[model samples]
Target: MTALPHHLDADIWLLHMFSSQAAREGGVIRRKVRDVDRIVGRDAFVTEMRRRGYRVYENAGQFVIFCNREAVRRVV
Candidate 1:
């Protein structure tokens, strides 16, 4: 696959890592949105995930993202 833009690397990587982990363990991926904003704006990061078929939510101070419906259902 083609590489993501430099500014989006960290955000995408974190999303991938959490999604992978969640897919395996049926858990939600909770991340600090501010951290993502440092590399790519929080809105952009969230938009990217949404575009990729992931669900994104802001709870407390973090972004909760999940790839699989089962994972999301389990977490919720």
Candidate 2:
């Protein structure tokens, strides 16, 4: 059997990413939707974000993840 790609493992990648100072400080993170899909899958990404009480927004094939649980409001 062939080995799976490293990115296919979401837990490890998520741990690494979230362990960063920026993430720890609840800074915004931007990632490509295709990258997330390829790494952790779109559903898994969304589920993980929700589980962590974070917010996610999608636009133009990109995903903007808010690392904090604060309420988000849109301003016109």
Candidate 3:
């Protein structure tokens, strides 16, 4: 399982963590989160993500994803 963001609910945090690791391992993070209604209410999750140096945004379909360019640079 993936590590969760501190402010996210158990399910979303787990999903996010898993997707993140998948991406790092050269996999695509291309899943749809069914519990969208559960996430928008939690602003703290957004704040925590930004603080972690990730750039988050919604897609045209309203999916949320995050990435940290600086962190990627450091790793490379």
Candidate 4:
């Protein structure tokens, strides 16, 4: 694959809606979203696990995303 994207993609879509409190530093962790019923909100490009039919993380009664290490490797 090419170099990692410089910016969050604007195309495609995924389920990520973690609350600010859940945001963490260093390394990533999938979070859950609450208001993902609409489209324009998802941050484009679904989480790797979500795409591969894994248990996408969740928190505070919502679907969130943190990065998926294993699924991504298998994809490429």
Candidate 5:
């Protein structure tokens, strides 16, 4: 796995949480970001998500993922 930027720690953690949840219950996962700006910016976050084969969509300060349904599901 490629090293992620230090600033994206929170974003990475957020994804881990969603992935854990998805493993138990498969479907779309939604997580609310109290302040989106406090987390990694959209470009960097999306880039990492894409690299991990996740399809990410942001709406109203929330990041949504239907990761399991994506064509590529492997994280690494």
Candidate 6:
């Protein structure tokens, strides 16, 4: 029912976020699910992350993105 504040496209915002210093250094990035869905639909967000070879996990209405493409293993 309301318009978003920023005019940037979903893809552009994603690219910019991924290109941030923290991401470039392979740091983890967290984003709110509602905001991402508002700016970039859930499908688009997941697709883009997959396209960029990033690993994402959702918990508590937030998404945790692993910036690196390194292999992930479960050690438990």
Best by lDDT: 6
- Cα TM-score of candidate 4: 0.29
Taking the tens digit of each residue's C-alpha lDDT, what string does model 6 give over 1-76? 7765565678678878888988999988999999799899999988888888999988999998989898767689
Tens digits of lDDT, candidate 3, 1-76: 6743566665555456656775466433432444443543336546655665555455564544444444332245
lDDT of each: 0.67, 0.84, 0.50, 0.40, 0.62, 0.86
TM-score, model 2 to reference: 0.81
Model 4 misplaced stretches (Cα beyond 4 Å): 1-26, 29-32, 40-48, 52-55, 70-76
> Model 2 clash pairs?
none
Q: State the lDDT of candidate 5 residue by residue for 1-76, as single tens digits.
A: 6755674576666566655856447567766654344565566666766765666667887877665644635588
Q: Which stretches of candidate 3 lie over 4 Å from their true place?
A: 1-19, 23-40, 71-76
Give lDDT tens digits, candidate 1, residues 1-76.
5755774677566656655856557555777777677656777776777676677778788878675554344455
lDDT of 4 by residue, 1-76 (tens): 4532433232333323232333322234443353343433454334434564444455677664443333433345
Backbone collision tally, model 3? 0
The true-versus-predicted C-alpha distance at residue 76 of model 2, in Å, is 3.2
The deviation in Å at residue 42 for candidate 3 is: 3.5
- Per-candidate TM equals 0.55, 0.81, 0.42, 0.29, 0.50, 0.80
List of clashing residue pairs for candidate 3: none
- Cα error, residue 23 of model 1, in Å, equals 4.6
lDDT of 2 at 39: 73
lDDT of 6 at 13: 82
Better of 4 and 6 by TM-score: 6
Ranking of models by lDDT: 6, 2, 1, 5, 3, 4
